[model samples]
Target chain A: MFQIIKNEWRFLVRSRLLIAISIAFVSILLLSIFLGNYQTQKQEQTYQKATEHLRQQWVSIDAMNPHSAAHYGTYVFKPANLLSNLDEGVNSVTGNVLRVEGHVQNEIVHSEASQMQAVSRFGKLKSALLLQYIVPLLLIFLAFNTISSEKQSGRLKLLVLQGAKPLEIILSKTLSVWLYGVLLLIFVVVVYGILNFQNLTAEILTRTGLFFLSYALYYFIISGLTVFLSARWQNATLALTSMLGIWILWTIFLPNILMSSAEKWYPLPSRNEFQSAMTEDRSKGLDGHNPSDERGIALEEKVLKEYGVDSLSQLPINFDGMRMQADEEYGNSVWDKHYGSNRNILHQQKKSFQLGGIINPFIALQNTSMGFMASDNLHHQDFLLQVENYRRVFIKMLNDKQTFGGSKTGNWGWKIDNAFFKSVPDFEHRPTQISVVLSNYIMDVSLLILWSIVVIALIFFGTKKIKIV
Target chain B: MIQTIELTKKYGDFTALDKLNLSIKEGEIFGLLGANGAGKSTAINMLLGFLNPDSGKVQINDIDATKNAKDARKIIGYIPENVNLYPYLSGVENLDYFCRLAGLKYSKTELQDFLASCGLQSEANDQKVSAYSKGMRQKVGIAIAYAKKAKVYLLDEPASGLDPLASKELSILLKKLASEGATILMASHDIFRVREVCNRIGILKSGILVKELYAKDVSANELETLYLKFMQN
Candidate 1:
């Protein structure tokens, strides 16, 4: 087996076509890394400038009412992961800038895809695209004729007569092609690492390493299946065509059909419907501006009783602040109920997409690749959750200041200095741990492992009935 | 030794090999003479453990060929009509690869000696097989068989496309190998060459062995007459 593999490697390296294709593949990977880094740097610079500017504006503001300052919110920029260079995932399509203000939750805006023309939907020329689409095609081309060619030319009979088992022959040929793909993947990864050595973190390294594992498994599946087809088919052309057709089905057609089906299966509410529902729910709750509403009256009465005051001005703290805080609390619950349901639907859709991996392992590869890179929907949701939590904390601080800063119920002129505004913490997003992120993609990873095992088993068992003559 | 007991093969309704029995002892060269689709290759394939017999058994060196193909094939060497090898590899490399597959390891010098012994030019040893003539490729095949030290050699039309000189050279090589105690089973249409090299010859027609005779007991004209009679029937 080793001798066969060695000879195959020698043959592949000597072949001018393979050498040319390999060089082109490496060049594409380098170009993807450069483009990714350039985009990331540009985004980082823009966000850094925006954040600094916001901070300066906050510090230079004149003394203003704490409630007014709460209305004037800030922005949180999503940080770019270095692994995104290899697999951008859904980041290009998703928004990056999130606005954190009082009273209302804002969606992240300014997605890169939204700014591009319709043609960008075909996707960028990223490393992930090549790895998922082109590399597998190349692997199929290399492996589809490994056995059939030998059989066609009558060398297979000689091989069998020379004490080489059909199983060993097929396995060795598959491994040779798999090793070729592995080498290409390793080269691209090494180059990517060298280019971003400065930005290498533990998380980045782990993600990239796992990325290699996923792609290696995928390549093995491709090679094993192609070689098995080669052994099963009588001629090289049939084997090549069958493998090519499978590649097209797996990568090109199936993913789109499955995604659309998943969306139809677990449809999400449109933006208008979602906003209208939230608005209706908010209206039914205590109106923050209309303190004379029944809910506000009940809150005021409870606060007065708790303070042992029967009159409007007898309370130690401002009644208006208490009412506003009550209203804000109700609004938070409404936001949670609506957004939580949306998140659930998204999760359902994701699981639906993941189920496709059982039939098409390409889906598993794409899911795992995007997931580990923190560019998928799961990571985006994590960032949004953190921003929402920050919004709550930020609003609570201002409400507390307004109620306890020696202000009366009707004192609309009450204000806090810059020192107090500075005391409130800025929005800092802590990226979810790799372990937690991996939990969300366990199904995808398991499917990939399962697919690899199945393909290998099929090659060994499926060729048992093959007719070498 | 190579032996088959009532070997038969079928493809749905078509009988490829009939219940034919034969045996060849060590150090003997047997030739199977037949026209196209007479099941000559089929018989060789069955002995080499390539195609399973529909009803019968094959034993190679006293090992069950069907049930223990790998072990049976260990002592066998085969050269197809075209001797198609990895065209990108040099003659020596191709020989070395096949030799390794047969569980034999040879150094470059030994490989070169085997090729030279088979009448291949030393200069062509390092050239890719893609550039080799048919005769040169057949010489490499002989080198591979020699290097493997196989006990049984199977040759399918081994002299078909070769020029007269190359065919004569192949005959000499087979005779020498037989003299060295190697058992050879050659399937060919060359009656004169078979009469010259084979110790015994079998004429096959429609998957059946129609005639069996010793080379020493018959002349070239007699062998042709017998083969033509079997093929025409």
Candidate 2:
């Protein structure tokens, strides 16, 4: 098998056209890595600057009402990790800067895709694009002729007569092409590591390693399937055409069609409807602005009775702050219900997309690549959850200060000093661990492995049908 | 030794090879003469274990070729009519690759010696097979057979596209291999070349062996007359 692979390698390198293609492909992959690194560095710089500026503003706030300070709120910029430079996943389309404030939950905004012109449909040339799309196509081109050419030229019979089993020939040829794909992947990854050595971490290295493994599996599938097709089909042209068509379907058509179907299956409510539903639910409870609301009145009466007082003046703390906090608690529940439903829908859509991997391993590879890189929808949702939790903590502290800082129910002019504002901790985002993230991609990873196994089995079993004559 | 018993093959309703029987002993050269579609190639294909006979058996060195094809093929070297090789690889490289496939390893000098023995010029040895003539490709095939040290050689129209001089050289090479104790089975339309090299010849007509004779007992013209009469009938 090794000898056969060596022979194949020698044959490929001896061809001027294959040599030229190797040079061109290597250059393109290097260029893509450089571009991806540049974009990632730019994002890192922007995130750092935004975070510093927000932190400074938070610490230097003037003396003001605690409630007013809660209303003023700050922003948190998502951290840009090293592997995102390679895969990017949904990072470009999903917003990175999330605004955390009092009373209302804000959506992330200002995504890179939203800022781009409509003409950028195919997206920027990133390493993931080449690895996922172009490299597999290259492998297909290399393998589509692996067996059919031998059959066409009548050399297959000679090989068989030399004591080689058909299964051995097919497997060795497929491995030769698969090794070529893996070599290209390794080249790109080594260059990426060298370029981002300063940013390397254990997690980044692990993610990059898993990324290579996933792509290696995908390439094996591509090479094995193409060689199998070449052996099965009598005509070389027919084999090449069939493999090319399958490549197009796997990479281009199936992903878009399945994504659309997933969305159709688990559609999200429009923004208007979502906001109106929240408003209607909140109105049924207490309105922080309107103390005369029925729920608010009931709460006030209950508080006064609990304190054994008949009027508001006998209360020890500001009922206004208490009411404000009550309103916030209620609002949080509302946000949870609606946002949780949306998140569930997104998860359902993702699962639906992942199920497509059984039929198209490319989809499985895409999901696994993004999931490991911490750039998929699940990662983005994790970040939002963290930010929302911080927002709740920051707002609750301010509301607590308002109720207990020697302020009356109607004293709207009550203020807290800059020292108090500085005491509230800054919002810091900790990325989800690799283990946690891997759990979310279990389906994708399983499907990819299963697809690899199935394709290999097909190649081994399918070669038995080859007609050496 | 190479033998086939009741070897039959059919493509739909057409019987490609119909219950044919043949035997070629060690150190002998046997030539199969037949018109197109007379089951000559089909018989050779069966002997190489490239096709399964519907109800027959092929034995290479007394091992069942059908039941254990890979083992049976270990001693057989085949040169097809076209002699197609890797167009991108040099003749020496092609020889080296096929030698490796046959579980044989040789130094560069030894490989070149095999090619030289087979009449392939040293100058053409390092050049790509794509630039070589059909005769050169056939010489590479012969060099591969020599390097494999195969006990049986199967040639399918080995002289079809060769010049008369190259064809004569190939015949001499086959005679040399047979003299070295290799069994040779050749299928061809060239009755003159068959008579020149073959020890015994069989004329196949409509998937049956119509006539068998020794080369020493007949001249080339006599063999051609007999073959033409058999083909016509």
List, residue by residue over A100-218, the lDDT tens digit for candidate 2: 88999998988878888641366767888899988988998899888989888888888877767788999999999999999999998999999989878898888889889899999
Q: For candidate 2, what is the lDDT?
A: 0.89
Chain B TM-score for all candidates, comma-separated? 0.97, 0.97
Report model 2's interface C-alpha RMSD after superposition on the true interface residues: 1.2
Q: Cα miss at A196, model 1 (Å)? A: 2.3
Residue-level lDDT tens digits of model 1 in B129-223: 99998988998987888888888999999999899999999999999889999989999989999999999999888899888889999999989
Mind giving the per-residue lDDT tens digits that candidate 2 earns over B1-233? 98889989999999888888889999999999998989999998888777889998998997899998878788888888989998888999899888888888899999999999999989998998989999999999988888888899999999998999999899999999999999999999999999999999999888888899999999999999999888776
TM-score of chain A of each: 0.97, 0.97
Error of 1 at A24 (Å): 0.8
Off by over 4 Å in 2: A118-120, A306-310
lDDT for each candidate structure? 0.87, 0.89
TM-score of structure candidate 1: 0.96
For each candidate, what TM-score against the reference?
A: 0.96, 0.96
C-alpha lDDT (0 to 100) for residue B60 of candidate 2: 92
